[model samples]
Target: MDTEALRWFQLVCDGMTVTEVAHVHQVSQPAVSRSLARLEAEVGTPLLQKAGRLLRPTYAGAVFKRHVDALIHRLDDGLAALTELTDPRTGTVAVAFQLSLGTFLVPGMIESFREEYPRVRFRLEQSHDALGSSMVAGGRIDLEFTSRRPRNPAVRWERLFAQPLFLAVPRRHRLARRREVSLADAAEEDFVMLRPSWELRTLSEQLCADAGFEPRVAFEVDDLPVVHGFVAAGLGVAIVPATEGEPQPVGAAAALVRLTDAGAFRDIGVAWSRERRLLPSAELFRRHVLALKGGRMPTATA
Candidate 1:
């Protein structure tokens, strides 16, 4: 049915004369009268009746007006909800990252962002880099933090920081006392690493290959802290990242030595799908992260 016709019917039924409704709507009296007639014809019933000089709604007209009123109310509510969803100060952002970032990098970034947008909320997910990038491409996550660029063409990866790889050794190990050591120096040592599914694991292997020997895998672990514990216990030495600003503590159990090899760094970055439009809150978060690209990201204490 024509909504404008129904609106005219409602106005006339509320005791307004046809001439008055026409003047209020800025239409001619004949145009308003024709619209009412069309509405009556469509409904096959008289919706308005003349009572002296004013018009009043018939039973059918009153029922239709109530339904129209409800629809209008719902439309208004939907519009308001859409506005809030896009508003930077009132929206939610969903982000995904590798488990390693949870300890230091992600938390600090979130805290800083919340300081600026106090009303914004977050839904955070921790997963391995591959799955995190897949979530972003699938639209399950608005953004992702990963150690390497995603292979998916739909996702755009922006480099945020380049963290140098470090050699983690037991405190009693000979190389632990060195300020910097070459990967070749520990070629014979057993290596503890993240599972093969992790990007860091692949990067570690590639670095070993570049160092001219394959690292003998002693054990595979998923968590960075567990890797640290194993290295501290002298089970194995691992290649780890030196996150900017956050240094790995050299305790009696373990020490972190810088890798002397040139270009031995992992590029940490943010990824998002190009096909999906980000909410205002997500966009703000993206801009904030991009602004920090020139700066350093804190690494997890191994």
Candidate 2:
């Protein structure tokens, strides 16, 4: 296979016009055209067809693109691993985490990590707590910080912290007068809740069910920031993990109250696949996580 030609073809598949790809690579249009012809000849099929002045990939090209994308991703991962192995301090670490980790855990640890390894680069992704476990399990990310622990046999976890759930409400709401609220009390009110798929939402629902009432959901959203906004706007109250205790919503009024009968709390942790060997950068992250004041490593699962 002509790796260079295939790479150029991949770029064209990614919405780059022939002239654009040529310009980026500092090659003439004729050179790019020749390379594409050579690639199509080698593959024994046309990869793209002209649609007016623009080129679009054929059905076969679409299939090839999926395979090529996976190949390119694996190659990139390999390069990243090689860079780490050659110079661990100068390589990049790709981490994915839920918002709470981004808001609370990463800021402090990233500062300390960068001070010790000044050359290390980090690529961070903030995802919902619901998807964090699956992202780690599928190898889409090196390390994941999530509130929900994976039940998958292929994944391993380390408990980082436990945060108590608190009722956040607009200050003018009737319930805002209370210092603390019971789960039963919360169930009676219209709630602005996390989407049902989220771990926090599942926990809230379970708690409400235990209280013998379904929560009256007035609004539903995925982000805590948005949830705070809705609650602050006097839409309804919600239960959120009290990681930093009380958080004041900007441009909105809200207060946090402890939930009495919501006996359970959410556990935030780092999860990674047990089947895959940890990359050097990922191992460094594992060390940093363990070093957190309340973090504890779990026993390796069989």
lDDT per model vs. reference: 0.83, 0.77
| 151-218: candidate 2 lDDT, tens digit per residue | 88898888877778888888888788898788777667889987877878888888888878998999
Please provide, for model 1 over 1-50, each residue's C-alpha lDDT reduced to its tens digit, 9 standing for 90 to 100: 77777777767766788998889989999999999999899989887877
Q: Candidate 1 at 208: error in angstroms? A: 1.4
State how far residue 162 of model 2 sits from its true place (Å): 0.5
Q: Which stretches of candidate 1 lie over 4 Å from their true place?
A: 1-77, 131-133, 247-253, 297-302
Q: Every model's Cα RMSD, please?
A: 4.9, 12.9
- Give the Å error, residue 279, model 1: 2.3
